[model samples]
Target: MQEGVIVKALSGFYYVEDGQTIRMCRARGVFKKKGIIPLVGDKVTYTPIGTREGVIEEILARRVELVRPPIANVDQVLLVFSVKEPELNLWLLDRILVHTERARLPGVILFTKSDLLENGDECQLWVSAYEKLGYPVLMVSSRTGEGIEDVRSLVNGKISVVAGQSGVGKSSLLNQLSPELRLKSAEVSHKHGRGRHTTRHVELLRLASRTYVADSPGFSQLEFGDMEPEELAACFREIFELGQQCLYRGCLHETEEGCAVRPAAQEGRMAPWRYQNYLEFLSELKDMKERRF
Candidate 1:
């Protein structure tokens, strides 16, 4: 059996690339009987049945799994945000970060449309804030090719997934990184300043010998109740560490007396927006628990 990675899955066929060539294969009955659906980015064992055809026999263990635009074994999630045209939304950015943390995948924040921003202070502030929390940040302008090389370096020899709100130039960024993509791009609504969906499905694009990028649909609305309230704090790396100092042993950090997180935010030690988003997530988790019980 030859080992290969699932680059794309459509209809009932999986396109597996084994370094040299890509084969169109179908999952074996064993996997189907076991209710195991192989996703793009999954490593599998398959036997070549024809020159460009094979049968996927076994799926290897996954390092990470994402629900929307389903993918697995992703090394990192590149969160793309635009400085202009569908302005950056801190709430959405935080939601993506929480999702990445929950999946134990590292995050790299990418800011697009830098050229459109006259000063770029707002975008720079966010980049600095996230960088303080140990996340890598890159500013790229697809139109000007600014910072494209840095973004490309991050994708080399790894499987990275790009996600962001519509109109943040996620597809445009992909096109810049790999000119071969030529993915569809949409303009932001002038009246609402929001982008229409351009990416319809999640497919892994092989950029180089070992670099793969999964372009996912732009999420206008994302839910974070998948994790419990107690577990939510862990999603924010810096806050999670500072929260331990709160007087209350099990403090949720919202309206709680002697909350270290609040003080940190007040002292400008932590990004206030990050704390606010955490509280919002905490409230949502509380409501979800109430409904569940």
Candidate 2:
């Protein structure tokens, strides 16, 4: 028996890495009987059947799991977005951040193509705003090699999931960080204003010793799953914090009387766009609840 991590799953086979070598593996029949399906990023114990093949006998406990891409033990999510090209969709960014918060995963915002921005005043504004809200923000350009080292330092010794809209340069950045990866990348379509989906599936690539990153398939929209309307505000850190001072208990922070969060947004103490997104999400969640019954 040996201990290793399952780095990739393909066509009913799992490729497990045991530091020295990778072994093609299959999960034990007991796991299927017990309704257990192995996922990439799962740590497991396996028995070597041959030089390069094995059987996974036991699955170690998982630290975390993401539903959309279905990867496990994720340490953080690098939410990449382009400052140009497709343009910065802050609404989309905020929606993803809310999901990350609900999953209890740390998320870093990476604005790609810094070199393409002729006037970065708007980009700088967004960076400052997110940073003020205590989220790690990095402006990276794979072509110019800017902010690559900062990204490397952040994902060091952690299992990171690189995710965002298509054409935000996720694959390019991964290639820049780890050239050996040679991950496929595509240009954004000028007609559609979106990047073609180059990454077909999720596979963790080791960038450094004990540091793994997964380049996930790009997605533009996501639906909230089984979350209450009241829980939405808590996902926004600044809103949740300021909401404590609201005069009324159980305030949804949407035009409520004496709402501290609304006042903070009005006074420029909080990002108004983010606050507006919060209200939008709150409304969406409310509508979802109404549709449930």
Leading candidate by lDDT: 2
**Please, what is the whole-model Cα lDDT of each candidate in the order they appear?**
0.87, 0.90
lDDT of 2 by residue, 132-222 (tens): 8789999999999999999999999899998788888998999999999998889899998898888877788888877899888734568
Worst 10 residues of 2 by lDDT: 216-225
Give the best candidate by TM-score.
2
Q: Alpha-carbon error at 233 in model 2, in Å?
A: 0.5
* Model 2: colliding residue pairs: none
Q: Mind giving the per-residue lDDT tens digits that candidate 1 earns over 137-158?
A: 9889998989999998989999
Model 2 lDDT at residue 105: 93
- Extract clashing residue pairs from model 1: none
* Every model's TM-score: 0.94, 0.96
